[model samples]
Target: MGLDPQSRVLIVDDFELMRTMLKRALGAFGFTNFTEAADSNVADQLMVEATVTRRPFSLVFLDWNLPGSTGYDLLCKWRGNPRLAELAIIMVTSESDREKVQAALKAGANDYICKPISIDKLKEKLEAVGLGKVRSA
Candidate 1:
């Protein structure tokens, strides 16, 4: 199932490098409608703007640990908001403990990808959880 190229994807990370890497990975996979935020505050703002504008985002790739609010906190915030809770969230982080992954899943991450993400892995995970917004012929 191919995702619509017009659909939106948001990337949240404190490091510009991670954001750039994710953007490159997704772009390599053919996802065109993408947005990035270097911090939790900006990320929250994006979510609010998207929701209030009634243009709910399709996918969000978030870092597990951020400067202030952890990605888990942001996930909780989004999950608490009914309108935003429905959005798909994928956690991208360096932590890969089974317990942490389980906790994130319990907290409502649609899926979680550990640090050093791979293009093929991202594609499979996105598709598995419905972020496959673009595909090759």
Candidate 2:
């Protein structure tokens, strides 16, 4: 299935500006539903609550660094849970090492995007993950 404009998205990042930028980028692609978490604990809680409420997030933009837990840890934790396994999670971070990318993929990240994120790159990743057929900018 392609990207649904109505799909709920979670933006997990410690920086408020980063979250706003991500949300703006997604908005360009017609996505309006969004939730923000400044740390892993809040992110995890929101994810579970959404799932339990039958309003699970369809996608997540998770940062690599956080106060309590790293994004990789969260990724692995969610992937290991059957209830959260299907969430399309994209690791959004400053880490550009090949090993890090591979590790995130191995841990079950649907895609990865390095900062400072470009709209073009974001669109490409979204398309690759079957989110949608994004038109060229």
Name the top TM-score candidate.
2
Which 10 successive residues of model 1 have the least lDDT summed? 128-137
- lDDT to native, each model: 0.84, 0.89
Task: Return the TM-score for each candidate structure.
Answer: 0.91, 0.95
Candidate 2 global TM-score: 0.95
In candidate 2, stretches whose alpha carbon ends up further than 4 angstroms from where it belongs are 135-137
Q: Which residue pairs in candidate 1 collide?
A: 3-132, 3-133
Residue 32 in candidate 2 has what lDDT?
86
Q: Provide the lDDT at 53 for model 2.
A: 100
In candidate 1, stretches whose alpha carbon ends up further than 4 angstroms from where it belongs are 1-3, 131-134
Q: How close is candidate 1 to the true structure, as a TM-score?
A: 0.91
In model 2, what lDDT does residue 89 have? 92
